[model samples]
Target: MVLLEHPLHGAGGREAGPAAAGPGARGRGLVPGLSLSRSLSQQQQPRLGRRDFRLVSSLATTRKTAGRGWSIRALGHLAGARPRVGPARAVPSCMLGCAAAAAGTSSPPRCRSRALFRLTAVSDPECSGFWLKQSAYREQPTVRFRYEVLFVATLGPGPGSLLAWSTFPAFNRLQEDRLRVPLLSTREEDKNQDGKMDLLHFKLELPLQPTEHVVGVQLILLFSYHLYRMSTFVMQSMAFLQFFSPVPESQLSMNGDLKLNQRQLLHHCGLDTRYNVSVVNGTSPFASDYDLTNIIAAYWDRNVTTVFSDPNPLWMTGRATDAPFIINATIRYPVEVILYPLKTA
Candidate 1:
């Protein structure tokens, strides 16, 4: 068990000074109201080359003011975390509300809280393929002020929009990770003592893979405040295409009126699977954007293989490749992919 008198230490902010002790040694006791305490424990056996780690924790704090006592306890495990080594130690960025996503062969767990974010969109008849009309979130003006996002490689296809989500890297080399995003503004905030997180707005841009028509992309967001981190996997999508050979236009922009499955859309977003949402069936090229229409028709109207989105993007039941977010198409064709930025309502 890891114990610290200061909440900052919960995420390994300060090195283990002489005050550090093991489980049976001592656990930090709570103060009436003037101080902060946090406890984080790792349950997994140590592994050699690993960044992802699981933790089991039971946390509670008590304080008194004006002769009135108040306390809160958060038991059970927080979300799973990926670690980052700081100046002196290997620390797990405290993930408060994180959701599992599909990566390579493994499917990590996923979740939602006042601080968590979920995805939702529907097919459009008048625009490009689709538009995200809503994002699932709640408003909370509580919890202490906390937060960087670090970009690792361009996860295939190539350059696209960057996202800042639930948990971010606690300690990142600012020099190495560019894209200095300005302080973000959200519609809701967590300012009071409430443990709930406020709703936040998010935007995502997907990069395109050269020569490939029907591939998928993943969007992972990191949000770090003080010592707390929140990472949410927003999307793992199999996109339909509208190629721009000579005049490359926006990819997956909501300007096109395309339609897709609701459940698949929700699944790609790491949402609950029981949702009944619309899936992409076929294309009705917009009157404008003839170039885009022709491109979509060429592939969607052709003999291209039609695939479907997985009911859920979880590792066990879903594939990282495609179909976890799709449905049978109107015609077999390559779906041009585009990325959409999601906003809070």
Candidate 2:
């Protein structure tokens, strides 16, 4: 006579043999080939009855291969609704069945079936697996800056008694009478050869008349910043600096760091352009668009920004009559830690 048994224990159906009654036979706790049959008969029937039994039987009968076992494939089939083995990830379905069967539970099929569909992705075959609640990472961004300067050189002690110039065409147009174009030399350096810019050297030389003197200065620089690790983030940001003194100065030198200022959390994934707009509207001919007060106010409204932190500046008072007023600045960009949600499949 033939005895039908689960592949988990033995082959399809076969008669008992001498090897079945060997020394380890008792350790298996089975009487010849009738062990699995008796155990299944003793267990309580599931809600689906024979259907659940057939499902388990059919799932277990699939062809096996090397490097991989039957349990993982079976679980993936049931969870992903297909016979394809997915990513090297673990799910709760196969574990539930193994645990239920080992513990002699009343309903192993029912327990496993529920867990099989718990974390399944119906549409995406790649994203089918159980995973942790969340994850994060760190990143450093690539930054490129452009010169957008505005400086004031006073000639006398009155409101409109100063010479000024800016890179903005609109602002320079308004200051045509007092405007003086400066020769700007700017370059970005990657000290570590890591592809990301680390430092910016800015040097500007503004020619002056013999009697003209500079007692105050105001400057602004713009940057096109981007991030690519967690999400694609783009924005136009700026750094502004201003200082004035009663005594006239021949040169201004500054050294500072261009640091990130974030007031809100960034998105875990996808493109973000909330602060991507220009800091100053160069296209607009309106004087308000070029107003320093208006530009700074609009920039402060953003949740993310970059600031120039210069604690001490050097100002020299000795100038030859024919010499030009020089301004030298060094801005450094440092590495940063970013927290983002991890993707799973």
Candidate 3:
């Protein structure tokens, strides 16, 4: 973002006093070479004076016009010629010129007050699987096992006077997917010691079962400004990232006899594998037996803690189950899997 400073006016300089009075001003206690009281007395003196009201009126008009010109110039300088990334457009040069000319005339334009706020765009790099967890099943009936993960982020104070947080609606779902957690909480922190607030946080939650597989995830982040009266200013700063797992393809299928490819496996599991893969499984019938393979990829598992910290702070931890076989042991099928970035508005 660009920030411009305005020059200070009326600083360390001699100011012009009231305009010189004319012949008419003499009648109103305004005159050169005479004290104000004496001038008033002379105007009231019996049978003695001629009043030049037109001359006094002209002086007042000149003073008012000069003051107006000074004010207009100051405003024009403060509102730089360039346009920022907000709703307001740049003030036309012609308009400013017209105002200057008017201020130089006898009838000066009235002053109007206006307020403006600056916006800053900020975000951190995407952090991959920061949390992981896994658990084994004993004799539990409700759930045999569970898996969970978490991500964290940290944001600093903005460079502008006013700061606010807003998420891009189009990228909200993608963020949830990449983080592998439900959007639960958000908070702002004051980190600059400027006696002001600046910072944001998001919390997510996810559940996993021992019999399920791991698949890739995509996420995105958007930044904007929130003004008073429910108004908002959109920004261009955005972030995107994808997560991947290290599991081999041999362990991604249901049976040892299925010839499931990555593409087909992901398709059967309703997942995109080109970008990130969490789980995959496929089974095929061979000449004399059945073959199967399963694939799984993820940043964290039941034993690790993942923290996503950069733009903001997010903590995630979870457990996951191994790829389990399908109920139909002898069935043969083809599977395909692909993962990539999701489209953004």
List model 2 lDDT by residue over 47-155, tens digit each: 2246444444233222121111112112321232312222333232322122222335422232221222222122333332344545455666788986666666676
User: Could you tell me which 10 consecutive residues in candidate 2 have the lowest summed lDDT?
Assistant: 63-72
How do the residues 1-345 of candidate 3 rate in per-residue lDDT, one tens digit apiece?
222121111112211111212233222211111112232233312211223222222223333222211123222322322222222233211111122232344322221221122212223123212121321211101100011111222112222211111132322233443322233444444455443334334332323335333332223332221111111211111122233333311111111211211121112123222332211111212211100111112322212111222322121223334322111111111121222223234
Clashes of 2: 0
Off by over 4 Å in 3: 1-183, 193-197, 225-236, 248-345
Best of the candidates, TM-score: 2
Q: Flag regions of model 2 displaced more than 4 Å.
A: 1-137, 154-156, 339-345
Point out the higher-scoring one by lDDT: 1 or 2.
Answer: 2
Better of 2 and 3 by TM-score: 2
**Candidate that beats the other on TM-score, 1 or 3, i.e. the better one:** 3
**Quality of model 1 by C-alpha lDDT:** 0.24
